[model samples]
Target: MLYSIWRYRHFILASIRGDLKGRFARSRLGAFWFILHPLAQSLIFSIVLAEVMRTRMPNIDSQAAYPIYLLSGMAAWGLFSEILTRSIGIFIEQASAMKKIAFPRLCLPVIVWGSALINHVLLLLAIAVIFLFFGHYPGFAWLYLIPGMLLISIMAFGIGVFLGILNVFARDVAQFMTVFLQLWFWFTPIVYLKSVVPEKFQFLIGLNPMTPLVGLYQDALLFNQRPEWMNLWPAIVVGFVAVVVSFMVFRRASPELVDAL
Candidate 1:
């Protein structure tokens, strides 16, 4: 699979380029919309929830504390959601081409992954500028975003491919994922600080693999602190297992994928 994907590396890049062009062909703002949408979400959430959560936020002394924290979490969540959601639907969305074309089927997901990384890079750059405006700089800790994004992409792709194959057969998996992701987002402590959760409910948050990942992001962007590596082991273990298992399942199911679609 890896060799086949590499054999068609140009196809993947060209598909990504075409996708970007087609998506923005009708819009005036074009690529700027990618940065604007997430920034706007962070701004709106900060405005509406900042006062209520301000007292709860700790360790950060800046007036822009809530916005910084929200943006950090959003950045991580944005990439994860974009990759997972797009992956789940890609097989179905490209069913026609898959039927007619002779290209490596894995390229569909790779295209989505590539496009998502581009959007993520743009969002990070925009967030960096925002950090400058707020007089908060992550400095050396900014390097953490690299591993953080890679971890997120791996986990999202794994789970997405597992479900995307199922969705091909069941169809309902797509509908179910829509609600699941929304609930997943709220449960991950993106909008509210984890410190604010009740002690009893804190255990629930701890059960979520994303909790620590988001905290890793918050530590880097909001506090300019190194992540508590001890806390990340569970997510790392889970992500690794998910990727392995999902690939195994995809390999077994690939022969039937075209028929299902």
Candidate 2:
């Protein structure tokens, strides 16, 4: 782990700059669009659902600021989903560089995930501004969100690296991930709350690694409450296990990645 981390530092640094520039190189708005995309989505969804459709999902409290609640959940979900989706093509997309330069294969996924996380942090800053304007103070409990965000990022990176390597061999992996992420998003609590789920279904929801993650963000940032540690601990354990397994899989497959490409 240490060796890979050390070897990949340059790739990480380069990828960050490359990814950022590649994303906005041709665009007039450049990096501003990164912040604008999420903010615009949050605003449009919040207004359309809360006003036009009046579509209030069952789990969240009726009196609660629904937009704030929804955006908090969406912020975490968006980062994970975006990273996983983009990481699917990392190796294939960077095949030229991979053949010419020997670098840690793991850095591919890390860079993709890191770029998306930077966008998420920007959105969180926007969320903080909105909260302040509304006279809602998140208090010290908001610190709990950092661990939750880290766990989500780790899980996303692990899964992304694993799938990324597989996608090198299987052209269908990216297509499958598209559908998988869509299903996973709805299965998660982004559009609904855990309390609204039926008792029997609640256990199943808890089994989802993303459940506790989204719950943690909403609890800490929106409700100004500490994360439910008992529930969160299981997700953290699962995330760590996922990371170890993914590392082994990616390492084992690294030798064949270029060949597969």
Candidate 3:
């Protein structure tokens, strides 16, 4: 167990370094795109959904502040969705490296999650700037976003690791995940607050671990409130279960993964 963790740690560092290098390998702005991509998405979504469309369901109260609301949710959703989507094909893409390298198979998704995290951090910084410009700087409660971000990453990593390994034997898993993530984005409270959902539907939505995960971010950043412990506990539990199951599956499949490639 200890050895696996150590090996994964080494591979994670190496993968992160490689990711940063590749991310800016040819760009003049270099790492700046990390900030720009999310910011651009937030800007466009905010404008189209909040301004031009003037869209809001019947239940949401803060229609005026919906842009920041949606931005907060989208930031976390984008990270998870991107990692989940990309990690699907990681083993196939790195087939040569996997065949030759002695590193742990688990490291592939971790690396992708780590790189996505860099982008998420940049998005958070941009969110802070946006809030400041809007005259709504987040308070100390915003620190909760650190733990919230960690939870989201763990959730993404667990799912990604499972999918990455599975993709080796079933190429169709990657294609399915792309469409699934698109449907998932809407199911999650990215554009609408959970409060807007009816009480009966709330439990169904809560089944998706992301519902509470985004709630944590919104609580910390947008509302300046502490995370709802009752709401967050389920997502944490789901994430924990995902990690254990993913690790077991990945470990069992690692030897086969190399052969499949």
User: What lDDT would each prediction earn against the true structure?
Assistant: 0.89, 0.79, 0.80
Per-residue lDDT tens digits for candidate 2, residues 101-212, read 9777777777887788787887788788878776677688778878877888888877787788788989899999898888888788876666667897877787788988
- lDDT rank, highest first? 1, 3, 2
Question: Per-candidate TM vs. native?
Answer: 0.96, 0.89, 0.89
Which candidate should be chosen as best, given TM-score against the real structure?
A: 1
- Native-to-model Cα distance after best TM-score fit, residue 26 in candidate 3, in Å: 1.0
What clash count goes with each model? Answer: 0, 0, 0
* Model 3: per-residue Cα lDDT over 50-123, one tens digit each: 75334443444554467777778888887878787778888899899988888777677778887888878877
Query: Which sections of candidate 3 miss by over 4 Å?
Result: 51-64, 198-200
Q: Considering summed lDDT, which 10 consecutive residues are worst modelled in model 1?
A: 53-62
State the RMSD for candidate 1: 1.2
lDDT value for model 2: 0.79
Q: What ranking emerges by TM-score with the best candidate at the front?
A: 1, 3, 2
